[model samples]
Target: GAGVSQSPRYKVAKRGQDVALRCDPISGHVSLFWYQQALGQGPEFLTYFQNEAQLDKSGLPSDRFFAERPEGSVSTLKIQRTQQEDSAVYLCASSPRTGRKGYGYTFGSGTRLTVV
Candidate 1:
């Protein structure tokens, strides 16, 4: 019955470095999603997985961004060659199932990454 959670609610990174953020989805949830939110902008889907299978990743902004959900319940997003433009809040969410109306997603507070 745990809710979605993300680590290091805030992160500071130097340009060209790599950072990894973690997410733990609610138990028994079948779908997980990652999103990026820039300042004053809405969250944009970055990737998604259903029961360990990544179903969509076209939203990932660049090849430097990668994600994985090896166990279906927990996921991680890793960014290489961090750039200032990569600074944004990385949010994680989960739903009981994908494509089921009314089964809305629950989101974590998010990891705010700041590149300097």
Candidate 2:
């Protein structure tokens, strides 16, 4: 794909259900990031992967939230035990540089998860 692609632009999950969001970044992007965006707010960093290695996951809200990029290209964000509070947009971003300092990133449209 020419840009980042995310699956299931919209998802509706029942309470306690588990959901997996997929992200396919642009080819050759070394840095991948997952973020959570509450309604009317900016995206909050959730995790970061550098070439298949999870370099930073400190931003993950809880153990139920997991993200991985096995091949450094495609990434997945899995939410176990969905809750009403988990209803938000999950965003995926990719950057060409690993440093990530002042660098621009390409972001996906995001997966909007609604929990009921």
Candidate 3:
């Protein structure tokens, strides 16, 4: 795709249901990041992958959250046993640089998860 593309722009999950959000980043982007945004709050880093390797996952809220980019192109963020507090906008971003420090990322239109 020309830009970062995310699937299921909006998702509604039951409190205990699991959900998988997908992100297809621009071709050749070397870095991918997943972020969580609560209502009226800025996006918080969730995880980061450089190529197929997960370089950092310190920002993941809990064990229930997992992110992967096996082939380093398409990625998925999965949440298990979703809770009401998990309701938020999940964003995917990609950059050509190894780290996000000096480069700007191309972000996808987030997938908004609503837990009820």
Candidate 4:
């Protein structure tokens, strides 16, 4: 894929269920990011991986949330013990890690996770 790809475009999870959301960044992209977007709100950075090295994870809500980019090209965000408060859209984005502005990353359509 030429851009970020996310699976399970929409997921409905019952309370206490665990779910894994997948993301495949553009080939050769060194920077991969995971974000959480609450309804009507902008995406909030969840974690970032720079070629398999997780550079930041401070946005993870709790220990129950985890994200990894084992290959640097693909990533996954997993949520445990799903709660209603966890309902939101999970987004993935990829960049060149150039730290330069104007080169916006490519973002996936996002996975809409709904917990009930």
Local error of candidate 3 at residue 87 (angstroms):
0.3
Tens digits of per-residue lDDT for model 1 on 1-116?
47888998999999999999999999999999999999999999999999999999999999999999998888999999999999999999999874647688999999999999
How accurate locally, in lDDT, is each candidate? Answer: 0.94, 0.93, 0.94, 0.92
Q: By summed lDDT, which 10 consecutive residues of candidate 3 come out lowest?
A: 95-104
Model 4's TM-score against the true structure: 0.95
Error of 2 at 75 (Å): 0.5
Model 1 per-residue lDDT at 7: 97
> Per-residue lDDT for 38-61 in model 3, tens only?
999999999999999999999999
TM-score of each candidate? 0.95, 0.95, 0.95, 0.95
Looking at model 4, residue 44 earns an lDDT score of 98
Give lDDT: candidate 1, residue 44.
97
Relative to the true structure, candidate 3 reaches a TM of 0.95
C-alpha lDDT (0 to 100) for residue 34 of candidate 2: 93
Candidate 4: residue 20 Cα off by (Å): 0.2
Candidate 2 segments exceeding 4 Å error: 98-102
Tens-place lDDT per residue, model 2, 4-62, is 99998999999999999999999998999999999999999999998999999999999
